[model samples]
Target: MTETLDTTVAFRATMGRLASGVSVITTRTGSTPIGMTASAVSALSLDPLQLIVCVGNHLFTRTAIAEHGRFAVNILGEDGEDLARTFAAPVPDRFAGVAVDDSHGVPVLQDAIATVVCQVSQALPGGDHTIFVGDARHFTHKSASRPLVYFAGEFGVMS
Candidate 1:
């Protein structure tokens, strides 16, 4: 008899082939800052200018963003690949070597291609992750630079 293939592996392989921009989702509560490398993000609205990020339920940054009611999406540039990998790993103090600036209250990556500050408009449960819908508050206009892209389990610079 033939063995059944794992759907989970299939899903991952298929998605891995899809090229996507890299971004860091960040927030702070009190004096503590939180960040994570995320590729599961996209715009959800235009009238109010909003976006959604899928964060694991147990992620510390997810809880912090909920508590703080705010977050900033730092779009990584070609040079930000290292930063993206750092944030993706479970290393302590992901922001250890990262430089940031406080815009309003959100911590924005100084070297990011762009920074979009947003307020949490809704938090919806989606299986193992929470989908946070954020309404854009402030942002930096896109600058001249290539973005970091992830594809097939690897990182690359956009042409």
Candidate 2:
């Protein structure tokens, strides 16, 4: 038999053990743009070019992404901590003064280490979070900058 976890406590402990790359998930809502700092993103496959992102059900960006049907994942560079926090907060104008442009109807941050515009291929309920599977249509990368990393609830820079 499989051992069941205490859930809440076990979840924090288990997640704390996993180190994740930091990303800024962006979706446009009407004329406004919304985004959030996320670490729970992973590549799913290369055949169809897919990736998975886990978003909390209550986040506004989650709803925006669903309605918009697409999103851009901006993989931040080492100097992007402030930009990440700006988008992650519950502010009215998250994209104000930020240099971003539309990429196939998705918002892509400028100077990101990498960016991927994806169409929502599937969405499913995953306990406290929703699992979003996306099919990447366009992608770009820069070899110059090091990526900003998130691990154990903190932001880190690769040296």
lDDT of 1: 0.90
Model 2: worst 10 consecutive residues (lDDT sum)? 1-10
The pairs that clash in candidate 1 are none
Which lDDT value does model 1 have at 80? 87
Model 2 per-residue lDDT at 147: 89
lDDT of 2 by residue, 45-139 (tens): 99989999999998988999999999999999999999888877888888888888885797799968999999999999987798999999999
> Residue-pair clashes per candidate, as listed?
0, 0
Best model number under lDDT: 1
Question: Which residue pairs clash within candidate 2?
Answer: none
- Candidate 1 residues 18-130, lDDT tens each? 99999999999799888999999898889989999999998888899999999999999989888998999988788897899985698899889988899999999997899
lDDT of each prediction vs. the true structure?
Answer: 0.90, 0.88
Q: Which candidate is the best by TM-score?
A: 1
Worst 10 residues of 1 by lDDT: 1-10
Alpha carbon lDDT at 85, candidate 1: 86
Candidate 1 TM-score to native: 0.93
What is the lDDT, from 0 to 100, of the residue 145 in candidate 2? 86
